[model samples]
Target: MGSDCFDESFHGYGEFWCLGDTRPYMRALGAIANLAHRLGDVDKSIAASTEALRLCHGDNMGQRFVLSSLLLKAGRFSDALSFCQVWLDPQYDGLNRPRGGCEFNPPNPELLTARLVEWHSKPWSPGNLLLNAAYAAFGLWGDCELARQYLVLGTRANPNIFVKVLARREKPDGPYSRPRTTNGTDEAHDYRWLTQDLWAEPEAWVWINTNRDVIDIVVKTCAREGCGRREMRPLDFKKCGGCRQAFYCGPECQREDWQAHRQACRQANAPPAPPDSPVYAMSGFLNDEGALDAMTLDNSDDSSDLSDLWEYGVEVEPY
Candidate 1:
């Protein structure tokens, strides 16, 4: 009945029919272990592969290799190393080949080539594997020179692989290098043409400093004030009363208590000014004397008491 069942199970599959009853269970368990390992459940993978190895009696080299790989993934370095040593032993060379009378070339060279290429492309590949093994051996077995050798190899493969390797190296402690100021001044260079002198234009200046804190403050203040593309005006200077350190559009705006600028103005203007001296002269006021003299003539001979004077001449009333 068991044979019949096995035959029924193996009916459609060529490999199943060939390898017979035991091979199916061994292959199935091995596949499951590989799947578990890929899923990152290393413990389950180790268990499944161990069961497969027990059932196969160490005959399946492929299964053994997979188990060894799983052991490495699970961080069982000693066991994995032992397994790899045994598998790669000269005595096991013939055993690594496919079973007798198998039509397929036993150890497919194409698969090996593809695997090697894939492993070589990995960030931590053959080099990392060797270094890790060497380091592990040295650290656990009190071999300092071996550890140093592995450390060197690891650094050559990937400098960042070991943190200690970089511990002694110095890194830039300040901002990155940038173009130097053209004038060779410590002040930062300004690129805005508006800040430069141009013909048929009034000269203006801009102070550019590399001090990031000051730049940040200016940018933030401009944003908070809703200042837009409109050029900052001189009248804006009136709004900054406290220290004359800020600006606005005009006096009306400065007086607009809604922005609480009046308080600032009061604070600024509150400081006492020196009294004007007699030596300080004031400018002349506007004069209307010429117009007053032109209207001073008298005319009283007309029949109409004030008709001619009212019409064409200046009337001087006797009062």
Candidate 2:
């Protein structure tokens, strides 16, 4: 959803650096697949989700989540079960650790994405997915042993999630990623607002997700209004120097659209808030009674405090 995150691309990377995928392409691919499913394009949905899974090396729960759901829908019970069980395995290690999310074990992508909004979606933990796969195994394939083992594993993983998080706190693993904010202020709320803007609306999410061409990397119409010129490449448009949020058809279109562009420029230049530090929030949750009372929470609004960090998790990937 943002510029490239590859170490190779960072010749001091920023928006202007490139308009390609940030590394770990699973999130966008998953979103595209999910959007396709919503549109009832089952074949396209599976294709997108399957491609996402193919790119994953067991690190991304989001990809696993989408692929498993699509497999079940496609009646690929064995593949679904096998995929989820691998994640459930204690030894299922990858280049990066599984994103159990800033909260909850076996992080649920749909719930995490919709946490700020009033939405009901299931989590994607190995335990939950195992149960899903088990249901399919027993019902669809008549595989009793597989179903039983999966159920056992699912239940075991479910109970131990919070415990594992607590243990993580007790035993320091390594320095975790810290939260960064613009203007040295609390950025969590701002981040939640962005995700809410992106995700809270069903149509908007689909529109944005579908429109971007990070894969095919082609565009016909200009991003600017009233400038529907054709014949495009990925880097054809000139990115606005001010906010870095938009790309002009050219210098002429940018100058011509200056009046409307001013407001956007401010927003683009404005520093986006960062999500709350995962470690800090988890620790606060564990000590909810009084431990977090002294913590300086930014009273940006009365909307939500936790949603900020939740949205931040998605913002890092922006799909």
Candidate 3:
């Protein structure tokens, strides 16, 4: 029962024997995937599940089912569905019907397969339903109607879990909670809060406070900024000369003053000021003059956006 005993027993087994022994490997991979998920490593979970699927090759319905589960968790609904359908199809059903063997005989492989097929067919039962819905909504996979169908089914099967999974995958970056101040007040106050100041900044702080590495933040910011759309090559922040916080599509973008990123660059390089300083005390400053100018221009074009900025600026002195 102990891990040492299992390890000792497992070591003597040959690779083909280990790979062919569906149940143990399936269980191991499933556990790995589940642990990875709980630890917030969806990519690891996906990798483990993919391995499980590969090992399940022939007739391993249990492993196949588990593979689908992990793929769903990883937001690969279409792939999960393909995996499910492969084994669940009527032609494959007999292949999955377990042959009686020593020390490991599935009680009812047909019944299990039937249950899984039914579950997967419903567009809900399996967790992948929500994943499919998300892909559908983003127009990554299918039509909105199909997405709606999956969403409805997914919600119907397990509303709370479905919603949670959808919300989590939608943000793949992580959960969305209003940031708390040191005093624990909701820190998000305005657009500036959304953009400037660590205490007030939403995305960067979300990345920093959540313990995400700098490289991860750069990758995410690039994705959000549609670097892919611009045909821009990815920038490696690790090689950056300064604060190493900001990432750009290229040297031109890095030099583009229009983005008003110098302040962020400066803050990244500048040592932390005293806690009592207005920049810290007021939460943040509008040091990005280009951003300010853009805002001013935008306000002149459309008064509504500026009204809140004007009111907030008047009520709170510039840091």
How much lDDT does each candidate structure score? 0.33, 0.39, 0.34
Query: Poorest 10 consecutive residues of model 3 by lDDT?
Result: 290-299
Of the two candidates 1 and 2, the one with more favorable TM-score, higher being better, is 2
- Runs in model 2 with CA error above 4 Å? 1-27, 94-125, 140-143, 155-319
- Per-residue C-alpha lDDT of model 2 across residues 87-178, encoded as one tens digit per residue: 55444443322322111133222211223221111122334455445544544444345554443343333322212221121222221123
User: Pairing residues by index, what is the TM-score of model 1?
Assistant: 0.28
lDDT (10s digit) by residue, model 3, range 1-319 = 2353223245422121234334565567767865775586868866775554443334232334334444444555555444543443455433432210111112121222445435544421333323333332323343334443443443343232322221221222321133222111111111111112211235323422333222222232321244442221122221123433343445544444224554554555566566665444533211212011111000011121221111211122234
Candidate 1 off by > 4 Å: 1-19, 57-61, 96-319
Q: Tell me each candidate's TM-score.
A: 0.28, 0.34, 0.29
Q: How would you encode candidate 1's per-residue C-alpha lDDT over 1-319 as one tens digit per residue?
A: 2455333243322233124555556557756775675576888977876665443333432344345445555556565544533443345444432221111122111112444334333332223333343333332443344333433343333322221111221222321123211111100111111101211122101111222322222231221144442323211122233323234344343333224443443444354333342211111111111011111011111121121111211121112
Candidate 3: segments with Cα more than 4 A from true spot = 1-23, 39-41, 57-81, 84-143, 163-319
Which candidate would rank higher by lDDT, 1 or 2?
A: 2
